[model samples]
Target: MIRIAVIGQSGSIPEEVERMAEEAGAEVARRGAVLLTGGGSGVMEHASKGAKEAGGLVIGILAGDRTDVANDYLDVPITTGLGFDFRSLILVHSCDALIMIRGGNGTLGELSAAYMNCKPTVAIETSGGWAEKVKQTAFEGCYLDERRTVEIHYAHSGKLAVDRAFELLASKWNEERNTGVTGD
Candidate 1:
């Protein structure tokens, strides 16, 4: 199973963007993909709700040991108790891929980490927050960095973003197959 981490803001956001996030989550579930998120409120909550409605397994990388903070829809809550900052790293590291919704600075940090680790990611570009801002912040008005470590797939709709995410995963898998894993 390919784990997909949905990174985005945890507070107030535009209703349209929130709906997009919800649709993204629903699409992931509809495709039989497991949904992963920071497990807080706002966009995370919307995504989880959509995924659960679609009968998908949802995992929450919670910031604390208590389950109270977790959204109502998570199937499994990994209570790292590591506090927000450290747990965010856990969220980035455990996933096979990431979907970036409209997000804040925290989402920016997740994007940076995903790039540093060469994780495949998709971005819903029409959403707000960092989704709108990051293209400018990235190097060469294109990529996150010179390493080309992580390719950001952009889509105008939630369903399209999730679709592109799967494409990215397929491409990455193909690259690994063709080049072969080096450690062996």
Candidate 2:
């Protein structure tokens, strides 16, 4: 099964952004993919809620060993005990693809990690934060650097972002297969 991580801002967020994250999580569930997040509040909580409501498995890659700090919607809490930055890396590495909503510095770091690892990522362009800013700041408008490792796809809504992530994942897998890269 595909594992899609939703990377975004924690703490207070706009209502519209919350809705977008929730919809994205629901769409991931509907498509039979597992939803992964930082396991905090704001975007993570909203997305987890949507995934749970849609009967999807939600995994939270928490920062500490305490499950109490994680959002209430998590079906499984992976207490990394590695703190936020390291835990974020685990979250990025474990997922096959990512959907970025309105994000802050942490989300930007996640995006960078995704690009470095060549993970398929779809950003909600209208959700604000790094999701919106990355389009203009990225090299040639998609890559994180001159390497052009992976093209970050952009969508206006959560559903579309999830759809694009799936498409990108499919294409990546096909390419890997055609190139004899087994990806094992």
Candidate 3:
């Protein structure tokens, strides 16, 4: 199954953004994909709630070696003792794609990691924070750098973002298959 990580802000966020995150998670679940998150509050919690409600598997790549700080919606909490930054990298590396909602510095770092790892990512453009800002700040409004390893797609809604992410994954897989280059 494809694992799609929802990268976004933690703690106090706009209601609209929370809705978007939840919708994205629900969409991911409905599509039979596992939902991954940082397992904290705000976007992560909201998304996890949606996924759980939709009967989807929710995994949290949590910081530290305890699940006390993780959201209540997680089905599996991976307590990584590697701290926040390292745990974020684990979240990025473990996913096939990512959906970005309203995010701050942590989300931005995840975006950068996704780009570096050539993972497909779709950002909700209207969700604010890095999700909105990166569209203007990124090179050619998509790539993170001159390398252009992967194009960051922007969507107006959570469902659209998840759809776009699946499309991107399909395209990438097709391209790899056509080129006879297994992305192993």
Residue-by-residue lDDT tens digits, candidate 2, 1-184: 9999999999999999999999999999999999999999999999999999999999999999999999999999999999999999999999999999989999999999998888889999999999999999988889888978889989999999999999888888898889998654
Model 1: per-residue lDDT, tens digit, 1-184? 7778888989887898789888988989999889999999988999998899988989999989999978899999999999888888999899988889888888998888888877777888788789878877777644787867656767888888888888878877887789996311
Using lDDT as the measure, name the better of candidate 1 and candidate 2: 2
Compared with the true structure, what per-residue lDDT tens digits does model 3 show for residues 1-184? 9999999999999999989999999999999999999999999999999999999999999999998989999999999899999999999999999999989999999999999998899999999999999999999999999988889999999899999999989988998899999764
lDDT of 3 at 66: 92
Considering only N, C-alpha and C atoms within 3 Å, which residue pairs clash in candidate 3?
none
- Model 1, stretches more than 4 Å misplaced? 182-184
TM-score of each: 0.94, 0.98, 0.98
lDDT, candidates in the order shown? 0.85, 0.94, 0.94
TM-score of 2: 0.98
